[model samples]
Target: MTVALWCILIAILLPYVCTWVAKISGGFRLKDNHDPRDFLDSLEGFGRRAHAAQLNSFEVIPAFAAAVIVAHLAGNAELVTINVLAVLFITSRLLYIICYLADWATLRSLVWFVGIGLIVSFFVVSV
Candidate 1:
C-alpha cells in the first residue's frame, strides 16, 4: 500500500487517540461513558480540547475519505501530489490538535483551514 493509504489508516486511528487523551486527562479511572455527550461535558481544559479535536476529526473524515475515493476513481491522480496533500492534511490535523490542547486559538484556526484546503486539493488533483 502507498504511504498515503497508510496515512488514511492512521487518520482513522487519530480521533480515537484524541478520545483516549480526553478520557485519561482527568487523572481518574473513568470508564467510557455510555453517552458521549456526558463524557465530553465532564472534561475541562486540555481534555475538553482533546474531545473537540476528536469531534473535529470526525467532522472532516467523511469529506477527506470521499475525496480520496473520488480521486482514485477519477484515475488521473499524480501519486506524489496526492501523497503530499494527504501528508499535509494529516500534519495540519495533528497541529490543530496540539494547538487546541495548548489553547492557541489563532494557530488552531489556521491549521483547520489548512486541513480543509488540503482535502479540497485531493479532489482538485484527481480532476
Candidate 2:
C-alpha cells in the first residue's frame, strides 16, 4: 500500500486504539451505559472530553477516507497535502485524547481544533 493509504488506515484505527487505552486504564467499557453526569463524575472529569474525541474521530475519519479517495481518483494536486494534513490530524487527535485524559482543558481544546482545522483544510484544498 502507498504511504497515504497507510496514513488513512492509521487514522481509521486511532479511535479504536484510544478506546482500548481507555478500557485498559479502567476508564470505561465499550458496552457500558451510564448517565453522562454520573460518568463525568466517575472519570474524575475526563469522561466527556474523551467521549467527545472518540465520537468526533469516528465522524471525521470516514470523511477523510472518502476525500482522499476522491482526490486520488481525480488526480487532484492536493492529495499529498491532504495526506500530510491527515497525518497531522491523527497526531493531534492522540495529543487531544491524552490532554483530555489529563484534564488539560485548554490545551485539549486547542489540539482538537488543530485536528478539525486539518480536516477542513484538506477538504477545502482538495476541492
Candidate 3:
C-alpha cells in the first residue's frame, strides 16, 4: 500500500493510543470497563489532557482519511508529496499529544494548525 494509505491506518489507531495513555495514567480498573466514559471523564491533569487529545484525534480522522483517499483517487499529486504530507500530519499529531499532556496550550494549538494545514494541502495538491 501507499505510504499515505498507511498513514490513514496510523491515524485511525492514534486515538486508541491516546486512550491507552489516559487509561494508564488515570489508573483504569477492570470494573471501569463497564463505564469507560465515566472513568475517562473523571481523569484530571495529564490524564484529562490525554483523553481530550484522544477525542481530538478521533475528530480529525474523517477529514484526514478522506483527504488521503481523495488525493489518491484524484491522482493529481505526486506520491512522494502525498506521503510526505501524510507523514507530517502524523508527526504533528504526535507533537500535539505531547504538547497536550505537557500543558503547552499555545504549542499544541500551533501543531493543530499544522495538521489541519496538511489535510488541506492534500486536497489542494489533488487539484
Top model number, lDDT:
3
**Model 2 — TM-score against the truth?**
0.70
lDDT computed for candidate 3: 0.97
Q: Encode model 1's per-residue lDDT on 1-127: one tens digit a residue.
A: 7667777887888999898888888554545455667867788999998998899888888888777777767879988777788788889889998998899999999998988898888888887
Candidate 2 per-residue lDDT over residues 7-123, each given as its tens digit: 788878877765555444545554554553354335534444565556667777887677667656666546567567767766887897788778888998888778777766755
Of 2 and 3, the candidate ranking higher by lDDT? 3
lDDT (Cα, tens digit) per residue for candidate 3, span 1-127: 9998999999999999999999999999999999999999999999999999999999999999999999999989999999999999999999999999999999999999999999999999999
From the highest TM-score down, the ranking of the candidates is 3, 1, 2
lDDT of each: 0.83, 0.67, 0.97
Query: Candidate 1: lDDT of 72?
Result: 69
TM-scores for the candidates: 0.90, 0.70, 0.98
Q: Where is model 1 poorest over a 10-residue stretch in terms of lDDT?
A: 26-35
Among all candidates shown, the one with the greatest TM-score: 3
Name the 10 consecutive residues with the lowest summed lDDT in model 2: 36-45
Q: On lDDT, who's better, 1 or 2?
A: 1
